[model samples]
Target chain A: MKGVVFVKLSEFVEETWGLALWDELLQEADLASDGIYTTVCVYDDQEFFSLVSLIGNKKGITVAQAQKAFGEWIFTELYAIAPPGAHDFVDIFEFLHGVQNVIHVEVKKLNPDGLLPEFDFLFESEKTLRFHYKSPRKLCYFCEGLIYGLSKHVNQEVTVSHVECEHNNDDRCVLEVSKVG
Target chain B: MDKNPPPEALDIQLLKRKIEREQKARQIAEQQLEVHSREIYQTNLSLKKSLDYAKKKNAEIEYLTKASYDVSSELTLFDILQSTVALTGRFFNAAHGINAIFDGQKVQPNSKPLIWSSGGFWDQNIELQSFFFKHFPLERAGAPPEWLIMPIDENDRIEGQSFRWIVCINFELGNDSSVWIGFLSKSELIDEEALNVLEIAKGHLRSGIRRRLSDARTVRRNIELQETATHLEDARKQLIQSERMASLGELAAGVAHEINNPIGYIRANLQVLDDYLKEFKSTFKLIEEKVNLTGSLSKQEFTDTANKQDLNFLLEDAESILKSNLEGVERVKEIVEGLKSFSHAGDDNLKQISIYECVGTALRVVANEFKYQHQIINELEKTLPNILSNYGQLQQVFVNLLINSAHSMPDGGTLKIYSELSGKNLLIHVEDTGVGMDEQTKNQIFNPFFTTKPVGKGTGLGLSVTYAILEAQHISIVVDSTLGKGTCFTLGFTVD
Candidate 1:
């Protein structure tokens, strides 16, 4: 009941990284859903999940590849939102380790500007969770969007976004997400 | 027969051989004798030559030694001069020599130098006199003999000039022996080269003259410095003593004021006591008189009671005793008030103070000394304005004068103090009819340490200190006195 869910990757990326590239990526991957569908990302030390269940028609890749792809996408999203001038993967890892809860993905057709999301996933912990994303240019933008989306969805603005690991491969992704507000 | 025949031929051969050997030995002996004779001849020739050369060298050394001894022997200026003339005359074979010394004033020829020479050429040669005068200028010349006159200097000024010349009959001796030397008459010529020898003999004359002049100035300066130091020391001592006396005066004033406060009350109390005692005695006396008049008593009983009490005499004596005690208390109070006023007189700053106030304060302070002894009469002008002065110092001046006046009067006398304003000056006069001072004593009265009082009774600095203080403030004091009659001191100061 408390797992993360993404109804649409476009809405999720728009709210997290503050970019519309996620809509293009979702259309290319053909992963769009109306009902709630859950996407889960598991790593060696930590795990994350998103559930999307279709209300009308579901168009996307297989669930396994979607999960993997979501993992890579989330990794890229974490890198985009990471702080500027962060060189060491460990520093990014520690930053992501802090936000263990309070992260969510949602899709909403009524909000044209994507100003509001349906669901928000938040990581909650005493320590900060840090990670690196593939798109280094969009790290700070993504982190700022994530914080704004989390503050708007939870009505609690005291959430922190962090990077968990180095994003060395475009296909393989790593992230540790948490919530602090 | 054959041997006899040949004898003559054999004899001839033997003779020839013998003769040849003998001739050879004789030739060798003759050559050895010739060598010995030549060696003896050579030795005699060398010995004779060495002896002649040694004799010649010994004579030359003796002459040189004699010349050196003769030249260095003359040390003093006179001796050097005399010997130079004598040696030159002897060397050049001249007849006479004359030496003249020139000073800036005159040229004096040495008499003994000319007298010693044989010829009287000095008297004959007018050219010599003119030559000497022309060459040896009176201002700058000295002992002369070598055609160059050397000036003798003491402290870098030419003091004397000596001229030396030879009177010669002929010029063969090259003008050496005819030299004559003379020195100036006014200044003594010292031998410069023989300073060590001549200095011992003339030490007293030169140094004595120099010291006499310098010592006089040194002695006068030393005396003046000593006198100044002594005066300064005396002033220092007097200043210290005056400060002490001022402090003592203040202490006495404070004590007097403190005593006056109590004595003032005590005197009042005693007056009341006296009055009450008088009233009690009078009442008691009246009762006794009334009792005696009204009551009847036995004669012996009345006599006994009268003898025991003596009420009439007791009443009479009580009034006198109370009166005397009250008078004594009043006297104590008066003395206290006088001391207080004298001590507190000059607490205020300097201003134009009335001379009368100065006199009053001084008299009050010394009132005990003058109370029953001398009568002070004040003839101060009522219209006289106050004079500008430090009030305390003025009071001190007045006190000194008053005390001096009282001291002069062993018995009782009159002291008249008066002041008047003349032009811009205030004249204060203290005249006393006491034992006056003679001229000698009065002359030295203002000198420190000159006192008539017995030793330890007076420091003798009071009048001199007062004189100094007054003089420093531009005030003058004049004294008029006649022995056995009176003395008056007038103090004058410029008014503001």
Candidate 2:
């Protein structure tokens, strides 16, 4: 896991629950860095799962729901961290489309060894965009949260749905996002 | 203790449930962590791909920049085309690439293309060449634009292989000049970046080809000008020679007529003198006979008188002297006559006459010139019909040809003259058994002032004049000759 994601999660937990819960979860997880994280360094992904699960249990929510919420929170955080020029996206469709060709490519430039999910834009129309998502991490719900987060960031009204889900034994997850009038 | 133990029992059961819950939570967290770890690994793989693609695109841009510079700087069109083909192959990862220019002359579908390809495959494939020529427009109206894309037919393929993608970029240089760059792949579809590279390369190709065409035109124009100048100089020389020949002919005709009068008197006077000599000899014989009968003097006295006069020798040699003189005068007359016939000008009357008669007259005119050295054999067909033509000019032409034949054989040889009636024409052949001319000589044999004879011996105008006269009469002449074998001059005259 990227240290940035971990940092964001820690911030999210500290803001939602409390700073003491964040500290206690880190200690319980027994991370390699002993609860210290930076935006640039890499960390074990297990620590992230442990922390999120603990947070989920404390809040009486499912693990998937916690992951989805974290995904939405990270989206807004990425938008804030992005350069001002990144705000030029016209709508959620534009922002989501850029994820594969533009955003992920830039990410690779920033971190030469960084990993990113594969996104293939299947089709596009005036009010709709569809893509196939393939990743080893079965995070289809997280991708769905990103689409909704894109809509929120662009201040646009849109509906995003999954026509195919890898969790349901599909080869890949297929997202169909449509713009609202 | 069995019925209602302390509250500690209920608390201990709740604690066990709590511990089980914690264990279940840890298992789920571990599974999710595994998924997240896989996701990171996949994302890294994707990142590597992105970097490679970026590197490929960067290399493409660098090559394109270099190609642009090379195209503009290359001195020749061939170099530019070669570079373009090489770069295009690299850009598209093409299996086959060709850069071609349409040479101006022929562009038939089967015509050889002016192409440069990376491999020898295109040169070996005739069907591919045909396909290219059939599709490419060698000539167009208002000129084809700088760039065009030619689509390949889905059903069309090459070299027993199917190509799903083939892109042809035609870069037109003005004035029906253009270059075509083609990239072909069997499986890989050309992407947007490749198309972009092609578009950029076209401008360079166009300018390079344009410069080449301009240079070619300039060189061609220079050659044309040089050729025109040479032709004009030749025409001037021919005109001067023609005028000089015309003036010489007029002078010759006047001299011939003036000489004809004296030749006539000299020939008549020689005949009279020969007759008088014959009379004198007979009178002497009669006197001798009378003297013998009368026996007026002794035999010694008569013999002495005869010896003193040298009468026997005089009688024998004097006749031959007069005959030789007559022959000389006759030769002079014939020469004057030949000169007059050759110089004869003006459109004379057309007379319906047998060609045999003309050949006979020509033979008589040139007989003394060749009779002693060559035998003249005539194979004229008596059944041949007469033709309406200028008798005098035809006789002159024949006379000149016979004289030429005579001159060809300084030693004894046969001069064969024959005629045959072909379809609507009379074909006359004058063949000689003499040393014939070579190819070069035969080619220039009828050119004015061109001759193989020595400077003083020949005017070099005989055959040329003959050619002019025959041409004026609408007759065609052909010469077939082999060195050391013979020459045959065939003349065709339309018979009406």
Who wins the TM-score comparison?
Answer: 2
For DockQ, the strongest prediction is 2
Error of 1 at B158 (Å): 57
> How close to the true structure is residue B204 of candidate 2, measured as C-alpha lDDT?
64
Query: Would candidate 2 be rated incorrect, acceptable, medium or high by CAPRI criteria?
Result: incorrect
Clashes of 2: 3
| Residue-level lDDT for B88 in candidate 1 | 38
Quote the positional error of residue A22 for candidate 2 in Å: 1.9
**Rounded to one decimal, what is candidate 2's iRMSD?**
10.1
- Cα lDDT of model 2 by residue, A1-181, tens digit: 7878877887788678766567667657777655566554578877777788887887899876788788877788887876445667776777776676677777777777876788889999989998888776667777777777777777887787888887677777998888899
Residue B199 of model 2 has an lDDT of 70
Clashing pairs in 2: A115-B43, A115-B44, A116-B43
Taking all chains together, each candidate's TM-score versus the true structure is 0.30, 0.38
Candidate 2 lDDT for residue A47: 78
